[model samples]
Target: MRRAAQGMLATIALALLTAPSSLARVYLTQDQALALAFPAPASVQRRTLYLDAAQAARAGREAGGAVETRVVPYYVGTAEGRPVGYAYFDTHLVRTLPETIMVLLAADGRIRRIDILSFDEPEDYKPTERWLQQFPGRGPGDELSLNGGIHALTGATLSARAVTQAARRVVALHRLFVAPFPPPSGPAPGKGDGAPPGAPGAVRP
Candidate 1:
């Protein structure tokens, strides 16, 4: 009887291993993400933002994380020495595993695009690319929580929440770090550029 039980468990494990989304990679690399976000990027700089305990707590609250992850990576791009935009990824729990979402933010902090890196959830529960269209042009000021601002997925509540939270997380993190750093004071040398871009956000299309 014990042998039979062990065989059953092994069969279960084998079945799970053969499952479609089980441990299968479905997302682009970080380098690939950056490349897609910027085809002809003049420069792509990797930046890290570390938050103090208090700020960490706040970030968690904003991201709906039970305990905040303190270190975050943000990528900034430039074209011909002019600011292009910012790119970042946020990982949040959905179902059992975590999903990484790559977000491309315009220079003004509005969401330019959202790329689902890997969603380890059930096939039926996967959010469609069309569904992601709802988030473009949204930014830190908007509440991305489902039903409040963004619409909710009928069946995939957790995935919807997880992604929405992740979006909010990165935008909030951007606001906390990048927004504070004042850009070149007054008018830039040759360009009419003056001051860093503001986060008034984008108009929904």
Candidate 2:
């Protein structure tokens, strides 16, 4: 009987070893996500913002979550010598794994689009496109929490919370850093334009 029990354990281990893994997946790259967020833009420029301690604290309070970093990177899209939109990428853990998403905002500070760049969780936990549609046109003042204005997913509670928090954080960051100062009109500065790095007009290489 002991030998039979040992054989059963070995069989169980073998079955576990042969089972498929739900590992990480790269659904889109930065370039692809940018294209989708800002279709047909004349130019796309990258910029960063460095928040002071006070600013960071206010941002965290506004977002209802911790602001993990003081250094933030955002993108600006332009067309016909006018600002078009801004985009921010946020990556956070869903359950025990990570998921990266891009939150694109219209010039008026409303959420324009959201795209999942990568996910390191089971596919079942990933939110569907239909569910994600609720984010667009939402702004900093909108209720983005689950069951507030956004509906909850049946089985993906962690994912839903992470995404909702990300959206709120990005919008709060935009209101604090980007909305107050609009990018200068006309073509964005090229390399060596002499704008200090992390300044409003600074461009990312």
Candidate 3:
């Protein structure tokens, strides 16, 4: 019996060593998270807008005729060795509702970036794949030059709007709460006390 118990203990130790670290536990695998982030589009429409910086000034001025409408912009940079503009999405399983938020931060309280990560109901929320694709490679100075004219995907305008607005919210939050808060080394604090690394929010895996 003692031998059998020792074998069981050894097996448990082996499993723990092979598992992903605690930090990795909180984050879902990329594929699994993406599944929740982007949903099926209800419809699609063709529209074109010039994403160039020069064109933005022209659109902002003339701001007439057929122009781009779905213009979303974001910044990309780094802080304390971490990429600052990649969106962060967090949600709890309790409410069955999640929030996707994008945040940009500098070493201090300044927003130098943006991206809309979300906690949304897939059925009610439009997928963001198309809208997000628009901001790639855009520089910090580029304006969300929507005077160009926004393309609408037939029945998908609601989805399009959701995507655009989410981007706007992210930008706003960046400006509001832009600080370099790195992932916590310990768990989130409880009612009055702080949580340590292995508890609740502290438990990653």
Candidate 4:
């Protein structure tokens, strides 16, 4: 009888341990961001950031130096009429700024591909993971007010704000630069642009 009780308790504990946390949320990818908000054709290339130090330095100047940035690739795919998925750079924004920033190229205003150039944050970052999910359907057009969309946690407001700001910055950059240019034939992305080093078959497009 005691053994049976122990077994039941163990089973319950296991279930609790594996259960999905209620606070967990999900975010979109680089390709998705473009689909939701297409940049002008002229601004597409300006969205990308190469991994070389010189380029990083240039980006620093552009972003007001001292802020690291990672370049993420967004491919926008479309369906019949309305927008579908919205993609953004998949790298952690607040934690990995300056190290990686995302660039988006959209087709039919939907995201179809994603490339994450830098992910300085630990892969298992728990606090910020839930917050990233809040950005998928939002854009500058959303006219997001502070304290809108997702609520910030009591202890993690700073991280949440960083994410929101980062998303806003990305959207603003695309709108400012890429929204005006005509669509050019997107070239096959090469190494060091956003591809993870030594990862075979890891192209964004």
* Rank by lDDT (best first): 2, 1, 4, 3
Ranking by TM-score: 2, 1, 4, 3
Candidate 4 lDDT over 86-144, as tens digits, reads 34463444553322334332432222332334443333433443455455445435643
Report the candidate with higher TM-score, 1 versus 4.
1
Provide the lowest-lDDT 10-residue window in model 2: 182-191
Candidate 2 ranges beyond 4 A from true positions: 1-23, 181-205
Clashing residue pair totals per candidate (backbone < 3 A) = 0, 0, 19, 41
Better of 2 and 4 by lDDT: 2
In terms of lDDT, model 2 sits at 0.81
TM-scores of the candidates in the order shown: 0.76, 0.78, 0.31, 0.36
Residue 179 of model 3 has an lDDT of: 21
Indicate the TM-score of model 1. 0.76
Residue 108 lDDT, candidate 2, scale 0-100 = 93
In model 4, how large is the Cα lDDT of residue 68? 55
User: What stretches of model 3 exceed 4 Å from their correct place?
Assistant: 1-80, 90-131, 138-150, 179-205
| Candidate that scores best on lDDT | 2
- Compared with the true structure, what per-residue lDDT tens digits does model 2 show for residues 1-205? 9999999999999877654324458899999999887788458998777766676787799899998877788888889978789989998888877899999999898998888999888899998898999999899678889999999988999999999999999998777656745334423332245656654434443
Model 3 weakest 10-residue run by lDDT: 42-51
Candidate 1 lDDT, tens digit per residue, 38-128? 7884688876665556766765675566436655668888899876888888776688776888989988878899998877777677777
